[model samples]
Target: MGFFSHTEKLPGNWPSRFHHKCTSKKCTYPNSPQAAEGRYVCLGKVNGSPCKGTYEVSPSDAKAAAGWISREVEREAEQSKKLMAHLQEARRRKDDEHLQLYQNELATYKRVLQADAEGDIRFIRQYIRDIDSVALFEPERWHTHLIHLREEVLRLQRLVRELQLKTMNT
Candidate 1:
């Protein structure tokens, strides 16, 4: 058994800044670069001996990485406010089905907002990277794409509800 025995290996060759510290005992190295085959190799020395220990690369400065996530949260909160208004309209119209759907979607939005606030560095970084790539490739269609995605989700939800109702009846 080892320190990383229960842990899965980390993928990719991330930069030194992304890595926090080495996990080897008594070897407080700052970063561990990936080997040729993608194993993290510690570059620390312990009492005149090469540490050469293998450890998972913990993320450095999660708060720093969460800056984009904070801005995204603000944007998502505004979107959720619109969703809340829609939910209110459904209530006013006494649309039970739509109200249920809106409640479910609002729950999902709250869960996502909670996750964003918790600041998962890897997820935040990947999300920012993906959004940046989309904006770069399809500058004009970015907002339209988001709108289409929301519509698609609503359509899918309705379809799923219809199927569930049919199944219950059958």
Candidate 2:
């Protein structure tokens, strides 16, 4: 888990500044002679954890830094692939669950609407029977109440029909 530390390039393979600490707090000299001698610093973690460990390498020692960088890149790539696959599986499972929930809700709605429509029909039938009885035995008793009852029956019938239409469309 190593990477090349960001450094400003100076002339002849020298870095402008070293991430290493200096003894003097107000030291103006950033590029020490030892640090400037083709040294490449790895400002990366020692393991997966952020240790901030710095590994210094000379230009002549390419094998050390190259091996660390290559291995880290390979490991990260494999980890990313596994994570991507896991995410895709989770998304697919969630989608299936959501679809099942939607279907269950639709079925519940249909059952409720059908029950309501049947109840309305029963009420309309009872009202018709009452109206027939009144017309036959007490025609003089017919008033605004009878008209309102008739309108209510018609309204119930319309409501049931609308429910039926909605069910069919869905």
Candidate 3:
């Protein structure tokens, strides 16, 4: 597994796959006279594959490879986070035209979702107000529709925020 830095070794089981016998005389695993029979645990990649231990890497090479992988993972994480923040800000912006479109869509959604006689007259009034400029809509009624539209838009925005928060937490 890759990480942004040298991960703390987990305690109680500093384990590794069986590697080759150590060549260094100071190395305990290979100090036996029959060094070829000695066992080892791999701590690095080999033969262009991972977790299939069959090669021994120089300590220097393993450290370098680990560092490279760590930096790459960190870079990717930073980029992904920046992109998500931008998308979230764009989603939250309140543009009237976009809000109107969402209002129309919400009306349709309400009709499909609500299974009762409360078919939402508020939707029809708002829809008419948007399309008809000459129609003399009651001022109080029109104002109430605008207020309801704002409330509905806010509710949808909150739902989107909740979904985003849930995804990020996971």
Candidate 4:
């Protein structure tokens, strides 16, 4: 039986595949290892050929992977908090366009958080890639953009008020 064939019986809802960098010299293939003979072995292909790289599995290696996953979840949670703040500001300003954008972003973040909490590594990874592909994961950029929009809205409001006053005097 192959290593991945028995992955459904593994404990802790671990992912069926764990990605590890190929250690082969001058080989740049991205390696994904599955358990074999009590250790993880690379099963990746290079240029349509099988890769021969191997990685030894250790307790510390498992711990490091878990830690990395936890850190990603935490970072996403922090970004969600920032998104909530932006959503509230959008509501206060009655800015429907930004309000809708923030709402959609928060919904996506919620799904990512839920998948991470349920230990669905595959879903989380895919979702993250989808987000990264669109370059929408930067909370700092969103914050700056919101500030600029707010300034423009205020400037336009001031212009309208000035026009109203001029018409009243004429």
- Model 4 C-alpha lDDT per residue in residues 1-170, reported as the tens digit of each score: 12222333333444433445444544444444432323545676767777777656556556655666677679999999999998876654554454445555555555555565697768855764664533246656544544554565555555555544544453
Which stretches in model 2 have alpha-carbon errors above 4 Å?
1-37, 40-56, 120-170
TM-score of each: 0.24, 0.39, 0.30, 0.34
Q: Which should have the higher lDDT, number 3 or number 4? A: 4
Pull out the clashing pairs in model 4: none
Please state the error at residue 137 of candidate 2 in Å: 31
Among residues 3 or more apart in sequence or in different chains, the pairs in candidate 2 whose N, CA or C atoms overlap within 3 Å are none
> Where is model 1 more than 4 Å wrong at Cα?
1-132, 136-139
lDDT scores in order? 0.54, 0.46, 0.47, 0.54
lDDT of 3 by residue, 1-170 (tens): 11112443322333322223333322222111111322335334334433333234445445655565567679999999999998866665534345556557666545523422355566555555565544335666545655665677568766655655654554
Candidate 3 has which clashing residue pairs, if any?
19-40
Candidate 3 has its poorest 10 consecutive residues by lDDT at 29-38
Which lDDT tens digits does candidate 1 get at residues 1-170? 11232253433453434343455657655552322223466766889898867655324334433544466679999999999998876655555565467557645544434445696556544544665665535646645644555676576567657645654553
Best by TM-score: 2
Task: Give the 10-residue window scoring lowest on summed lDDT in candidate 4.
Answer: 1-10
55-130 per-residue lDDT for model 2 (tens digits): 4435433455455456767999999999999987786666556545545545544443444457655544454465
